[model samples]
Target: MEKKQFLYMLKLVPELLDEKNWTERETAIIGEHFCALEKLIEEDKLIMAGRTQNKDDTTFGIAILQVDTEEEARYLMENDPAVAKKVMTAELFPYKVALYNPRFTI
Candidate 1:
């Protein structure tokens, strides 16, 4: 039962130069998005996910996903609160896990 998986890069909406500070509403949306991602991880759909740490740039997040097809990966991204709420946009790509520690296997 080896299903093909994909790697998706989720890019957050670029912060406005004038609006450098993140509003409370934006913070809330990100929090909810993380919660949703946590649930996906628990369900074994997401192998790993994390955000970029570049504070002075257009920071984005990356996720390793397990799905039956690329279409499913697109659907998952579209349904994510971050994307749905306009906090982020995503692009999916077929990927192969060439090397990794067994403890990190999905």
Candidate 2:
């Protein structure tokens, strides 16, 4: 099947920005979130994933994926540990990568 690109943006629950609200469970789920993204990268399903440095309401994260269908893309986004467990919420959108610099790394 041919693949299409999609992007999912994630926003943290307002309380998450305050370190006082972090419990072991929230920390573990975040760890799982990173692991999930790593797995996607290894499988070639993820093009890139990152977040803003700010800790305010404006802060957000994004993951760009290449998948066979929107349903698959939604599945991936909805299943992200942070999203699944409600540590964060996400919105999906069809996306196109208009330009990229091969040497850029972060």
Candidate 3:
């Protein structure tokens, strides 16, 4: 219940690989981590997460997450598959989430 939010910038490699080159094993491992993260969100351990289509070319995606503390947040980042494979980089920045803004049509 310590409510801390962060902006996660996930940087993907520039060299785009074919489906075969991507490797199923690596993809599966990353998928597994994502699945676990989804569960944590559902349980309120993670308030929310957001990522978008690959537009930045090098950036795989970006996300926003609300977790209990800075330690837990860093733990998640350190253990990410992207880091394990060294195919992507994650940089986290502390942010104050702007919620319930009537102007944005939320």
Top-TM-score structure, candidate number: 2
TM-score (C-alpha) between model 2 and the true structure: 0.96
Ranking by TM-score: 2, 1, 3
lDDT of 3 by residue, 1-106 (tens): 5689876677656553334456776687668668866776786655555566545554355556677787777777766676656766788788776775557531
Highest lDDT scorer: 2
Q: Estimate the overall C-alpha local distance difference test score of candidate 3.
A: 0.67
> TM-scores for all candidates?
0.83, 0.96, 0.70
For each candidate, what is the lDDT? 0.80, 0.96, 0.67
Residue 71, model 2: lDDT of 95
lDDT of 1 by residue, 10-52 (tens): 8867662224657888788889889988998888888888978
Error of 3 at 26 (Å): 2.8
Weakest ten-residue segment in model 1 by summed lDDT: 12-21
Candidate 2's residue-wise lDDT over 2-103, tens digit each?
799999999999999888999999999999999999999999999999999987889999999998999999999999999999999999999999999999
- The Cα error of candidate 3 at residue 50, in Å, is 3.6
> Where in model 2 is the C-alpha error above 4 Å?
none
Stronger candidate by TM-score (1 vs 2): 2
